[model samples]
Target: MSDLTPDRTADPTGSAGVESKGGDRAQYGMCAGLAGLGVLLLVDAARLAPVQSSNDALGPKPVPIVLGVLLLVVALFYAIDIWRGGVGAAEEGEDVDLSAGSDFKTVGLLVVVFGVGAALIAPLGWVIAGSLLFWGCAFALGNRHHIRGLAIGVAISLITFYAFAIGLGVNLPAGILDGIL
Candidate 1:
């Protein structure tokens, strides 16, 4: 029998039948990255001021601390799994054509749109600039309905503007609509 063929007599499940030459070492990089991110989060979270109020109890430390610990635990488990000769399964049910080249035209258009949005932000403001950005992105991605795209973009931008300004207390530039906004 060929080395590539699984030994059906060894195990019915076929998992332990075909021995991998060596477990994938690439997964260890992900484990390291997760651990690094966890450490960074813990450090950053530690730097936050422990300010407590009647309305906001527990401050801003618990969430990051919990997330950091969770990440560390996950990283540890992932590393252990990798050590046990675990390999990721191949993706299934996708109809992607791997041979097709990237569509640079759409990418270039999106870059231009993003640049234009950034340039317009200071002069036209977040609402208008964001609307243009959203619409332009949709157009670049092949959305043909100009009026509908524009309306949707406007609504999204307006909602985000209000959400950031009112909900988060972060002031996005009002620009031309300074007094009105």
Candidate 2:
């Protein structure tokens, strides 16, 4: 029982009858950053051309405007929650051990993979480029089934391309598969 006791009495960070937890200043920084992003989104939405009164109220502009407003509201609420002395919940349930230090190698690999995909997009087009991005990200994140990942990624990208291009009336560059796609 003596071994389980905490020597809080002698700790300078705490005082008698008072409990102290180290401040999560990072929360405040994150809140501010989110608030800034909300503002930027709102500004960008404002720059979008207004729909003619004849057109339906629901358009590209309204969705982004609503999202920006919601982001601002959420950021405000989070800041208030933090100001009221809330502590963040400990992260849990990830496959990786949280006790292990940061994995910079995996992070760098993911960044490089994403960069390569983005660079390839212009020449390779949506289906192939997006497939590479998806498969590369999965591989970087520890999925080792390269063939399975590539197949799944290519299928997803093709579905997404057709869905957006045919259903939504959006034009995606088809690149080498141009006429065939």
Candidate 3:
């Protein structure tokens, strides 16, 4: 039999042995968090000013309302599943070594890179700061081709900057390249 198959012999009642033990109580916290977030979203959506125009009739309220309702539904189903002792199955194909230690050096480097990138955003602009962030992350992850990585990073940053600032009509600080861009 496959590892995924439950052992019926362990429980004559035909339910998972966990049901008798009262299931996992820890998962209830996730359900409660989801429900709370759903309520918050609903409340926020309710507070939005009604917008009626010829171009757009629906406004921004529908999306948040739908999302909030979906979250609540998902939370209810998750709580029910948890009450029935339906725990998630363990991954069969995972190759992680549980005994191995975490690579803190890489993590620390990435964190520092992110912090520097955030600090430089207003001064250097999205293009320069984002390029540095991308290249720094690549270097942290062991990319050896510095010039290629930098070029790719610049391209990505420019694309995102144009996409968000011009295409999507979101304002991004132009910083040093304020007039040129």
Candidate 4:
């Protein structure tokens, strides 16, 4: 308030008359620029003819536009955060989690289930794919009670099938069992 001023001479960057937050600003600026680029790419993709096809009412433009706007919003948030000196302090401790274990059985089972689902989907349609994904994920998550896991998996799969196929009116592959043959 009096004659006291900020000790710019003691700044870490050693720039007595320069802004000391340049590193933080540069880091966030780079991230924001990259995010903006990603958003622009999606916007450009939405402008492509393939995305504007008459195959569907909304076509592919809707999703890309939504995603592009979302990315741009996030980029703006990052830029504002950097401007507010909200760059988090660097951590000095080890944060690694080395206790994780490999589950080869679950991994192998998931691959087999996906393969079977893919082989059957065109005939079985969304019902099979939804069931396979739910079951594979449940088993992978270590659901040891097979009956309970199966019940939950089937319920989720049927619900998803109804949502995607009936509610959303999205056509799923109905493989060898096309037309309920």
What TM-score against the true fold does each predicted structure earn? 0.79, 0.61, 0.79, 0.60
User: In candidate 4, which residue ranges exceed 4 Å CA deviation?
Assistant: 1-20, 23-26, 29-39, 42-46, 49-63, 89-101, 174-181
> Quick one: best lDDT, which candidate?
3
- Angstrom error of the Cα, residue 74, model 1: value is 1.3
- Residue lDDT tens for model 1, 25-93: 777899999999999999999999988688778989999999999999999988887777666553343
Q: On a 0 to 100 scale, what is the lDDT of residue 24 in model 1?
A: 55
The candidate, 2 or 3, that scores higher on TM-score is: 3
lDDT of 3 by residue, 52-117 (tens): 787788999999999999999999999988887777764354788866899999999999999999
Q: How would you encode candidate 2's per-residue C-alpha lDDT over 94-150 as one tens digit per residue?
A: 797646889999999999999999898889899999999999999999999999999
Task: Give all candidates' CA lDDT scores.
Answer: 0.86, 0.81, 0.88, 0.66
Per-candidate Cα RMSD to the true structure, in Å, reads 4.9, 6.6, 5.3, 9.2
Global local distance difference test of model 4: 0.66
The local lDDT score (0 to 100) that residue 9 gets in candidate 2 is 47
Judged by lDDT relative to the true structure, which candidate is superior, 1 or 2? 1
